[model samples]
Target: MTFDRRQIVAGLAGLPLAAGSASAQSGWQARFPELVMAVVPAENASGLTGRMEPFCAYLGRELGVKVTLRIANDYAAVIEGHRAGNIHIGFHGPSSYVRARTVTNGGVEPFVTTINSDGSTGYYSVLYTRADNPAASIQDLRGKNLCLVDPNSTSGNNVPRFAMSRMGIANPDQHFARVVYAGSHENAITAVLQGTCDGAFNWWNSEQDSNFSRMVNKGMVKPEDFKIIFKSDLIAGSPYAWLTALPADAKAAILKAFIEAPQKDKAAFERLSDGKDRGFHPVTHKDYETIVELQKFVDQMRRARS
Candidate 1:
């Protein structure tokens, strides 16, 4: 058959131009699995991979979609991907979620939160000092080195900073000898343990099965090596969110799958959900109002310092 240039041009022009429309219609939408699951390099990448691959495979099988894992080097990269909508579904810390929302002009919405096995959706940021250190409260750490997890961490930095502001200990930089970003909560905890930092801030729930307690019990760190000098009130847990442009059916399916997953596959669910949190629960942007308020406070503080 002879090629028809004009006819071909017209045909091509009429083809669907909407991004991801074809895939969405086929019920096999794509997602960045690694980013969506918050698998970090420092946290035993091999173990994370081993644990998540099967989980992703299971989700894909049950959801009737293909899921691909994408790993970014740091939290900022993950946040950027989320802002750009390259990542359809993501697990983001509260501070990172706030930044993503700010950059995207509120384009994202929380669909569900990973619940603890006990069905709680909250965690706390704890301020720790060496067991031998005399600091009794956040105020006592004045003129000392303070190690923070990261700028984009919720329990690691944002909540701790907000807590300090509430306690009238505004700007640890001014009060402390210096403020150091340890890059990760584990690092911050390590810094305090090694005597490199006078104190450190980290996220954990007091619940016995919480991540922090699990780490301590697993001998990842010695609980006796540090003491909690301060702790923030429970903050909402991280979210599993999607961009607002996601189709309603897909959104509903995703939420339904997550919320109902634990009952279907208890063993697999236990591996992903933090011990006490049962599973994901449906949520909306309104649920994160406190986070938005916290971000505003942080932004105001940044401006004041500048």
Candidate 2:
């Protein structure tokens, strides 16, 4: 089937504007053994899929089913996949998961969130400028071009919007000389280095491992080459989400897979998470209430602007 970006966004993220066709029934596990897991494509899709194989294999064993991985090229694709019942499990950003409930009309449930290296179930949404930009603060970046990750991204767009608003910049597009969507964290980081934008919005694990650090390690750039101008209070971590349409037993098994996968298959989980994550801790919609509220605020702001 052809990739459907439009349907995905319709069921994924609002166009700053804003489906419930799910029915959770028993025997879903028996009827559908191929559990389709959708992952947000934060980087190269093919490479990510290959790197995730070992973890998927391990999950398959735990569920006693065949696990098929689908790399949704952006956050919205994963959301739509879930709404269309094409996805069983989703490794979702906090903002995307929060948006899923509204987009799916309550067809999704977040079960657990990754615990980062510092033992927190969250990370930071940060702004970075070139090392020599001479910008000491977000105020300094006003009238400068900026790059943001996907609109559905937590650190990339959602939290940045909220944080920027709180910083007294009610309009990033107007304050920043120009606003560009860099598509992914890596791209946003690269954009700053390549002068695509004056600064960028990205994220960091609690360990301080971020796009900059990752680039530094890859010989792509130096740690001193970028300056952190703004860092939002920790946003809820990425979540292991499930469709409400799944059978109760299936959901239980999936949640168990997340909770135990780290301890039982430490190396695989670490490999899957690129060493930025430790494991998942039990969580509920309430744990992300702040993000829910933030999203509401973002919607209100966008509406007011329109």
Candidate 3:
């Protein structure tokens, strides 16, 4: 888990600094002396910070500025940070990025999104229950407790609701005996494993790339202890976005660093990607249009509840 800082620095020396020219580095740095990158709490704060620090350090060296990492308390905090112009870059789930765009009025733009190790750019929302729970499907869990990761979580909340609605369970709150927001993906999975909830919705990319897989790798949960009872259609992978207001040169520099990470900063990329992603692919708002529509649907559901 150690990154070769000297190797990374040496490799980055040949890459374009800013706007494809070394001279523009000072111009972009003058505008953004320090860049703050914020992320949602997909895992515990300490673990997330440890995983992100190397990537942040690599980005800082490539950009010639201090790149600070902030593990947001929740998805809303990341969105709010972008809205307030405090977060220069945000790593967000698809639905959270949609919300960030809405709140900022297109102020944030997605520069790159994850590419799965299988070469796909999407993942699934899965409804998981204890393997011995006898619930073969989401329908079998009627009148049972359900755990959602967070309101802004795509796989944990929005896509689950969308999949459930298609299954005729129009109102999850009413359909389930009780519903709870676990606030983060790890927490939601933990609730289900602890029997605090009968089931939880979380993201799964493949057999090797998933929240469950990561936990299993950490020995936090056994793979055989839980089963996915339901799975949603492919949802776009999470994105790394930045403020559109930043200088064009800065945006180019940031995007360049990410696009080159897999080659120039292999260890950081592996740690950040959990060895389950191929690399970052250039992306735009158009790539997330379907998610934008889905978030709007979830927003309407929220308004009705209020």
What's the residue-level lDDT of 289 in candidate 3?
99
Best-performing candidate as measured by lDDT = 3
lDDT of 3: 0.85
* Candidate scoring better on TM-score of 1 and 3: 3
User: Which of the predicted structures, 1 or 2, would earn the higher TM-score when compared with the native?
Assistant: 2
Evaluate candidate 3 by giving its C-alpha RMSD to the native, one decimal. 7.0
**Per-residue lDDT of model 2, residues 227-305, tens digit only:** 8888888788788788787778877888898789888888889876577777789888888898898889888987998
lDDT of 3 at 238: 92
- Cα lDDT tens digits, model 3, 176-195, are 99999998888989998899
Candidate 2, RMSD to the unseen true structure: 5.4
Extract clashing residue pairs from model 1.
115-277, 116-276, 116-277, 116-278, 117-275, 117-276, 117-277, 118-276
lDDT by residue for model 1 (174-221), tens: 889999988666677778878889998877766465435655754777
Q: How many clashes show up in model 2? A: 1
* Rank by lDDT (best first): 3, 2, 1
- The lowest-lDDT stretch of 10 consecutive residues in candidate 3 is 1-10
Where's the lowest-lDDT run of ten residues in candidate 1?
Answer: 1-10
Q: Local error of candidate 3 at 210, Å?
A: 0.4
